[model samples]
Target: MTDEASAFVPGHVTGFFSVERTDDPTTTGSRGGGLALTDGVRVTVRPAEETTVVLDDVGVEIGAVDRVLDALGAQATVIGETDLPIGAGFGVSGAMALGTALAGNAVFDRRLLRDELVTIAHGAEVQAGTGLGDVVAQAAGGITLRLEPGGPMENRLDAIPARSRVEYVTFGELDTATVISGDTDRLTLAGEEALSTVVAEPTVSEFMYAARKFAREANLLTAEVRDVITDVSAANGEASMAMLGETVFALGDGLSSAGYEPQVCQVDPAGATLVDDRDVDGEITGRSADGSE
Candidate 1:
């Protein structure tokens, strides 16, 4: 189940890359399902100029690609390029896996369901060492309580109520892998107790508390990181750091006051989508180095 690349920036909970499995059910507002979804920020990292790589777009074709093909016996073109900025704590590998699964599902006549696609996509991410909890958030969208990792799309996905939303603010750039690898404990925090309570707690209240706690941590929220959060928060936007310490995200009611301020609005409850549909005004085609278009 290859996936489209995505970013898993920091500012949330941390534990390195520990995967836990449990029998709890993740749902929201009486709506429920047996599926596990991930959350994170995702961006397309295109090169400043046209470029090419020498692999099978590893991000797009993880171990599950063969499984997907075997299940449907589908033959589709798997195209991937380093269009995403790596080492910046983005879930580039996760995005590739998810994107591949999404694309493969389309090409394979929809042999696998959406939940199945998510499972395959996540499997690929676990294999890669470049993710935090963003995969679960991005897969689930909105605000979520990622209880445990692995298998069958079983997670607690809660929609951000009308009064709740997120704001993503990035300041400067840092290598996500390096940040995590350097201190090992600098980015770690205790979200388990909080997450456990959040699962059955009121969505608004839980998020409000989490948002407050997230703002107070020092190791997770370094000085430089805090400054960005403070600037945005002072502007009436709630803020946090993205995984890898490179970017910061702020949550708020609305970003109208943040106009042209070089920050992205961070409230996506429906998850992320990649469309084959192109912008006629901005069509892009990736080619190999051999002058092949």
Candidate 2:
């Protein structure tokens, strides 16, 4: 029985923002928040020797994995997996990376801070381009507002408590890389400007509202995306797409619409953990820590 840890999937608002390109990523800040929902991915880590590895839907990438191990001078294998829909604007990759990295640290018997873990994960995403500033939201969970040009280099970690419950209504997969690659310059500019606005006055509700308005004005939302979100809203859920495309998110809960059994999730303040007994069975057992039995 190998030791391991699993982290809960926290819904994150994967919205786009502007930045301040000052050759300093830390100067960046998030302009707004977007629809964040849950994807099922429980990242796990196992230790063997002095090495770290990451596993995911797109197979394993060892570059960042090795960097983490080398940086810590520790020995371990980091494993990550996400049933969380890929390209759904849910930040599955970022979550997977962060979860796997933490697992590696644990396996190596190293107790690094969450901010430290976030830094490493962000670096990995930057290299992979598999994510945007979404890594910040995914790592911090709840309503996370990141400054433009965010990264560990910038030392940015801001948590915004959501005034409302936000969820995502997924329609189809958005090719994240395609959107990013196709409009690199435009998006970068947009992101930078948005960040500047938000950094000046960062508030979850204000930022999100402004972001949604900007998205509409910029025609960033595709016809299909807009229609889906509109239709879903009539049934009682606010819907929005990921940065470029690929995933749509629906906010709020208790929604009963046909063809969609909206998954119920909330902000997981407790990021990730591991259970010693993997053999535990199907019956509902423990009560929620909040005593919501």
Candidate 3:
């Protein structure tokens, strides 16, 4: 019996975070986390002759998926695809890991609980140093507000009302591990302040404004990013630099006029979901939500 499942997750922008570490393993997670974006990653799992992972976009080996398979004591071929640029602060790595864990559990017939799967994926990301609170935020979906952090269930989450359009431009990539591992005292303080300010208002405009302040105070904005933000602002649009990447996310039009085409997306309200590939009695038999088999 060959079973298959697929999951799609939205990307996120972490305005700021207060990191925490623990040897207890069970009680480990981040704190004071931030928002989720609309564009993200999708992963598919199916039985294979051997365990393997293929990232369709970058063609790279996914250690996070490999780690999940190892922990579950199951082998499957996993495929991840993302329109969002990797390592450009789109939270692609976290989305990939979370989607893989969810889809692989279904393909392996593990029957793992939602929180359990999130823990596995979240742990893999933390160990890999690819992200901190992305797995949690993506798991919750929408414009997430992570009040407290750890894993899926362990984190306290809220959401702002979804915006109509979210747009972004990518010029290059940044090493997330290097940036996250650095001294973040000032960044943490700035993030805390931004979090407090946004929590009071909690509008998309306020969030973006707070995020831009955090970027400037955290010293994460590059010259190119700053220039793009300035140009977009001059054109009467709100924009902010994505955390840990050299990418700018603008809220409206006028970026195209600045010689940069923006990729427009909407907020994904649903987090990860299992794709029904119903193969019954050795016969492919299943009707999709749209009444297609």
Candidate 4:
């Protein structure tokens, strides 16, 4: 029997954070206190004789799937595909880990609860040093405020209502591990302030403003990225540099008019989902989350 499933996760922009590690074995990775974005990652998994992972857009090491397989004590070929640029602060790794865990459980009939599946994915990413909060934000979807960080169940999340279109452009990748492991005293301090300001207002514009401030104060902005931000701001558009990446995400046509081919996306209201595929005759039947054709 061959089974397949897919999940869609939105990209997130973390404004600020205070990292905390817990001794709880049930949780994995340090707690990430940040914000979730609408433009993010999408992953699909299928059963195979041997475990294998393939990424469509960017080239990076694939270990999250292996971690999931180890935890489940099962073997299957997993394929993860995403349009978002990997290692570009789009939370590709976190989304892939979460998608693999959820889809693998379904394929194997593991009967794990939703929260359990999320934890498995979270643990994999955390242990791998790929991400800290992307899984939590992806699971919640939309504009999310991660008040407390840990695994899914161990974290506290609240959504900030936003229906605005998001535009983004990627120039290059940044190593998440290198940045996360570095001295983040300034980053953490700026992030704490940004989080407080946004939580008090909780609007899309305010979020973008806070993110921009965090990027600057954290000393994460590159020269090229700064130029993009300046151009976007000059055009009177709200834009912010994505954390740990050489990318800039703007809210409107400000960047586009400045000769940037921005990829436009919307806030994903639904998180990851399972897709049921059945082979009928010579055709395959696929079902969406709502059981629609």
Q: TM-score for every candidate vs. truth?
A: 0.58, 0.72, 0.88, 0.87
lDDT winner, 2 or 3: 3
Write down the lDDT that model 3 would get: 0.74
Clash count for each candidate, listed in order shown:
50, 29, 1, 6
* Model 4, CA-based lDDT: 0.70
Tell me the tens digit of each residue's lDDT in model 3 across 153-253. Answer: 66677877755366788889989889767887787788778878878998878877888898999888899999999988888777888777998886655
Expressed as tens digits, the lDDT of each residue in 1-293 for candidate 4 is: 34576655556655555555556524544333333444455566666777777777434456766898778777766666555677788787877788788777877778899889888888887777777777877777777777766887777777777655667898999888888777867776787787778889998888888888888888888999999999888888988887768988877565787779987765566666564434334422121222223
RMSD of 4: 4.1
Candidate order (TM-score): 3, 4, 2, 1
Best by lDDT: 3
Q: Could you give candidate 2's per-residue lDDT for residues 1-293 as a string of tens digits?
A: 33765554443546665433333333333344543344435666665654445556345554545555555565665665654555566666666666666666666666887668767766665555555566566655456656434665564556555544444556667665565545445655665555566667676544555565556655578777777666766775555566755455554552335246655455444333343345756422211323232
Local accuracy of candidate 1 as per-residue lDDT tens digits, 129-171: 3443454554565454555445336544444443233434444
Q: Could you give the candidate ranking by lDDT, starting with the highest?
A: 3, 4, 2, 1
TM-score for candidate 1, please give it.
0.58
Which of 2 and 4 is the better model by TM-score?
4
Once superposed on the true structure, which residue ranges of model 1 sit more than 4 Å away at CA?
A: 1-90, 154-156, 162-166, 172-189, 196-218, 253-260, 272-293
For residue 111, model 4's alpha carbon misses the true position, in angstroms, by 0.6
